[model samples]
Target: MAGSSFDNLPLEWIRAFEAAARMGSFTAAAVETGLTQSAISQRIGHLERRLGTRLFVRQARSIALTVEGDAWLPHVRTALESLRESSEALFGVARDRLTISASTSVIDLWITPRLDRLTQAIGGQITFRTMVLSTDAPHDDDTVRIRYGTGDWPQTYKQPLFSEVMAPVAAPALLHKDEAWQDLPRIAVSGPRPGWTEWCALTGTPTVPIPVLRFDTFASALAAARAGRGVLLASLPLCAADLSSGTLARIGDATLPHHATYWLIASKERLSRTQWGALSGALTLR
Candidate 1:
């Protein structure tokens, strides 16, 4: 037989082959596959015929792969896994578009409020996909990035939104009604400057050795503070909504300068029509 005719072997056939190989029993594969044992056997038979290979050796109670099947299973499995990952990423069900990387603090405390405002400011009706990565600098393909540093940004035109005024805030329930206001664990955010020391220096208050609970972002630290776990130092403007809503309370009036102000940064390329409108409207004095 110079050329044996075989029907078109679909992806389903290949998948069935892989599944049967992995499970080591056609009946078991059928059970996992939600197919009759005969159906699984038929798909594998069709596949082996098309490929002109002996994929498996059947026993009374189990199955064993031929040498070729054993050699090829890894490649087939790898290809299928790669396809699954890529498909999930492209479909948007498991991923997002227009990912905006920023500090967790910015996302939770600041952006959550003004996100609607920012979206409304943009011209088009495009909804953005956002994510938070723990990186100060933006890598390729990031549409917008926010950084907490002195306004000097590389390869970007920087706009200072507003200066942040720092304060030590906590749940009102934590502060004793009768005791003096000095005993609490300080939820210190990791940054260039120690907010507590700077705040104490500014207020001329006796700097006490307040125990520190370190956090990576203002958002997480704020949550801990709100739950009456400890006190957190944060910018009043960023935490304004929580403060006003009485979820968190201003423990004291001491304030300090943010080593870096909040900056809205974008790439130097001409802004898209939608982005131009969003940027202009967001920046406009209201």
Candidate 2:
């Protein structure tokens, strides 16, 4: 069918078909769209009737896309995503709102408290939602993002927020209670690069091999350190509050270049509104 021909299809059927295609299961799509599985199947049936083709092939418990359906997925995804983006982009001009995706540590420790100040500086009542995303760029719903990485963020218009400094930190109790920090369990946070391996090189203590405790996020690792479990490699800006509030203390004067830096990124073609510009500025200022 031609591109314009899709407009002839019912909106409800199109929604069901796209959801089913993406999820590859009628039940999953139904759960997502708040429709019954039978309803989803009926809508897809309607869509298939309109197109005069099969969209899915039923397996034992799941559904698989037909060849045509497989080919159509990206196009449908792009079309729907673009429509949603445009709707949000043009949403209410005077009361524009922006949704941002970022890491949890950045949001909880940095942005949440400073959001009011950011709104005040931007001169609008712009609403925001900070979702934690796995990737560096904004996904299907979000238009703006703050990512932690090196200066070069993948395939997006990214502005440098700031580079992070890496150094060892521990709770005062942990350091005081244990004289064998070199042998005690050490907490590790995941990123491009982690641990005292590089930091030790900077401080000239490479042979120091402390037992490692791993956490997927810096917040958890910092929490472990604050709980007096062990020392953690702290990202300076991300742990400012902990350092300031005396919850954690530096293990030594050792420092090194962190592999990750905070970045404010957006899709170049997708971002054109004044609200986005104000949001971008607000992110860096805080």
* Whole-model Cα lDDT of every candidate shown, in order: 0.70, 0.73
Backbone clashes, candidate 2: 1
Residue 192 of model 2 has an lDDT of 63
Clashes of each: 0, 1
List model 1 lDDT by residue over 217-272, tens digit each. Answer: 67777788888887777778778888899988897655776656767676634244
**Clashing residue pairs, candidate 1?**
none
Clashing pairs for predicted structure model 2, backbone only: 149-261
Report the Cα lDDT for residue 30, model 1. 91
Q: Which ten residues in a row are the worst by lDDT in model 2?
A: 129-138
lDDT for 175 (candidate 2): 79
Model 2 agreement with the true structure over 11-46: per-residue lDDT tens digits: 789899898887778998999889999999999998
